[model samples]
Target: MPTVLDRLNLALHYAMETDERVTMLGEDILDPYGGAFKVTRGLSTKFPKRVLTTPISEAAIVGVANGMALRGLRPVVEIMFGDFVTLIADQLVNHSSKFRWMYNDQVRVPVVVRTPMGGRRGYGPTHSQSLEKLFLGVPGLKVVAPNALGDPAELLAAAIADDDPVLFVEHKLLYARPLLEPGKGDLIDFQVEQTGGAYPAFTLRPADSARLTIACYGYNFELARAAALDLLMEHEIFVEIVLFSQLSPFDLAPLFSSLVRTRKLLTVEEGTLSLGWGAEVAARAVERMDGLRVRRVAALDLPVANAKSLEDAILPSVQDIVNAALSLVS
Candidate 1:
């Protein structure tokens, strides 16, 4: 019955308990207010010295975290909004991500930068932007955008335990949903689950024979799921959906094998179409496989719209994904 926010907080608690070196930093994270979305609630009280509240500077927050990582401490820095990440691009893309390689593995920067990303709920353009694609292109940075509530807990634990810098992008819309069934193992239990193991992989009951694959991340996974249901009920066409919680250092071996069986691919993202993650996936698919047809359903190639109606217009909808799937079948 725990909401996504509750699960995230639990994950943080587990991280703090497991690692004596783990620390958290950001605005409004220390005391009463608990974080803008309350994901960091009670953490300040539980780990007084480890949980730090900072000024309004994203650059400073990331810079301080990078310095800490250099000194052998794992720092989890929270950026209240994804849109604010642009202001600290130099710190993230230039410094933290490059330190290890730049120094020939002489230093390892273990920093997890968490930011609430995506649109909807009228946050408008300034506060609502999906910039995961921007960080995905940078070398030495691990990017993760977990769609399921349970995965965030596990994935955050894994990212924190990693030696490299990670961009843990949490979707704003997914924070209020119920915990995903598969990732429901007890937080106190530290057993490692097998790869590709599913608690319950929802399959379209009818099972169309078409060779089309739907790949998506973050909130777009929800839209793709709804569209997949519609495709099964109305069109009798079934497509396989591969939801990736871990984006950078993407393990595409499974996806590539699936693609060989399916023969067609469609990528959906909430971010802009041009130079987005979808584009990279499509390009990689083409390069790795011969005679593969791939398409992308993403936000229009324009600046994020400030108006709610225009914002909705720019983002990929269920209809868009469905149409793309249908096109692959046709």
Candidate 2:
């Protein structure tokens, strides 16, 4: 019985096995070391000719992936950390993202740039930034930040199948979480038991007694859930939590309806408050839903510190979310 991450690896392994065009390129994806997070473990051994290890340069990695995509190869490029992608923004935003429209749909860049993002364990400013907002504004690029552990495999597979560039951001915090294997089998049953409990499936809605709609994604979803529980238990208030798995090509239909129902919206994220994903969500909610009362919960507009205390202060906490929700309700 494979966990969700294990299933994701298995899917990638199987995809590469069947499709010769499916290839991988990253800093240390080859055998022995696997990947920095072992997501690509044993891939190089299985597909020696297709799996490639590149230098530490993200620009080069992205450039090569873009070139391969243009030449009819589906390249899954790993950028060790999300923070490092700033170095390759030129290739990702300018070339890979715009190749289709710039060339009048003459070429399609079917590339999946996977990166581990978010702050945990005091990784510091250099490695803690969540840059999804930077690429969200880029046209011709699809951004996906999967909330549940099991969602990434299907989402990644879909991204790979699509004939467009996709930025698949996987939170480092979710790597070890267990996910049930898809399909009915002895393996699936065993894995389901190993998961300990049912995987949480969340939805957004307007609550009749709700004061605020807490919109979140990735690790923030966990915090938002905890806060919702706290609000129910401690304050007798119900807050609707909306988790945004797909960030780019922003879908506000569900959120807009929720805003109309709740009237108040609070966007939360682990990233900085200024010009972050939460701000964008808040802005859009207000733009689309007239008279919506919107607020945001996010890290301060300052660089994260390597110190645990400072990092904790900057990152949104479950308590902070609860307090904000209560404030809105009261």
Candidate 3:
């Protein structure tokens, strides 16, 4: 079984081999260094010409990639960390994302910006942050994040092939987890199914009844799933977990259908409590479902501290999800 990072490497390799116009640029991504997380490991060695090693400038990387896209090339730019994506906001919001619309569909900007997010590794304030919600409503830009239960490699390939500017968010913790293969021993009695659309999504339901539904993405799903399983064993709370592959243009059909079975909903995310992605799900549920109870669990609105205790205190934990689920169900 390959780790999620291994699958990402395979996806990048497949994109490079299939598309001659696809190029990758990032800092310290050369053969020896690979990358900060080594997600791009062996790529530069494999495709010497298309793999570009850049300086420590996120803005510059986006600018160069935007130019490359304008000149008819699919450029994948990796910002070493998710925190630095703010530095490239001007380029993404003002130029690249607007190219297709501002020009009356005369041109297309097929650029993918990849970065790692979340804070389980004690990366502290700046290094670990789930800032995808910051770019959620940005027009002409698509935001996608892979959870523990889906094929990130296939989603990455889809993002690379799409004709829009995509913010590909990878949770730091999910990179090392095994890919969720179908019909695996652990999923014997569970029904695992995937949804097909611009954004691929997966749902896991137990053989019996589902008393509640949990919605999440990125590495946060690890905590969410653990809580769900614990609830099942301790309290007889059957849960259906829905993982989103695309954040913006969020595909909510799976969530809506799951809600039909279980009127209670709990949304978990690594971002801060206010104005987060979980809030969006809660609001949508209020609008679409009558008499639906929705609760959200997210990190506190503060910088992630370096110490393990402080990080745990600020971020959402499995206990938080368990308590929230119990409350929602009750």
Candidate 4:
């Protein structure tokens, strides 16, 4: 299996080849260097007319993509860092995201804003923060993320083709890891099943599982699985892991079923602890389900530090997941 970055690059190639309307615009996305992370390598070379290298302004990049999307072009824009998403919030939240509804469904913004998020490479606070929390509840905006459970390329392809505005999040740390397929690699000991949707959610169940389910997405998912392995091997604590790729239009279907069996949920995320994705999940579960206990593990509310040690402390770790799981079960 190819790495997440490989799959994403392949998705771009496939989308551009099949759909004439598909286009990409961003800074440094051209051939050779390929957009910082190289997710767009060889694309500009293939479709020189459509793949545009924009200026450094993130706001302008998204604004142009929004205009293209409204004009019947499916434009996938890239932000160099996820932290810079703030600069384009107005363009995204007020204009592009609301265009369809505000115009009474006459014009559609089929724009996919792809950016690398999460911290690990010590890129400092400006480039290393996970800011998807800011867009979770935005009307008409779909938030999608990819974990290693399945082919991320498929998810990216789906996002690019969707009619509404989508925020596609690529965790920086997950770029180089191989996609975790069912019955292979990181998921070998577990039974992985993906739900049916444009962005599928994966549920991993061990043959012998405890009454606790750990739910996470993106890069923290890698941490959760590792924590689960150690919890099972060293502490005899088994847990079911549910991975979600879709954040907005929040679908709890994949998780509700697991909660039915386990009746215990531990939501883990790289975002901060206050008013985050995990909070929404926990709130909805308590409202819809009966006799469920939920706990959340996320980064500290403070800013992400550039120092590796402080950064690690601010961000949730494998030990955090392990301890949270034990607390949930015990």
Against the true structure, whose lDDT is highest?
A: 4
Evaluate residue 276 in candidate 3 and report its C-alpha lDDT on the 0 to 100 scale. 93
State the lDDT at 15 in candidate 3: 97
Q: Following a full C-alpha superposition, what root-mean-square deviation does model 1 have from the true structure?
A: 4.6
Q: Candidate 2: TM-score?
A: 0.89
lDDT of 2 by residue, 158-190 (tens): 777879898988888777766523333212211
Residue-level lDDT tens digits of model 4 in 129-184: 89999999899999999887768899999999899999999999999998776787
Candidates sorted by TM-score, best first: 4, 3, 1, 2
RMSD to true structure for each model, in Å:
4.6, 5.5, 1.2, 1.0
Model 2 Cα shift for residue 9 (angstroms): 1.7
Best of the two (3, 4) by lDDT: 4
Order the candidates by lDDT, highest first.
Answer: 4, 3, 1, 2
lDDT of 3: 0.89
Worst 10 residues of 4 by lDDT: 179-188
Candidate 1 at residue 302, lDDT?
Answer: 72
Q: Positional deviation of 129 in candidate 1, in angstroms?
A: 0.8
lDDT of each: 0.79, 0.77, 0.89, 0.91
TM-score of each: 0.91, 0.89, 0.97, 0.98
For candidate 1, lDDT tens digit of each residue in 228-263? 778877987766767677777655655575687788
Q: Is candidate 1 or candidate 2 better by lDDT?
A: 1
- Candidate 1: where is the Cα deviation over 4 Å? 182-210
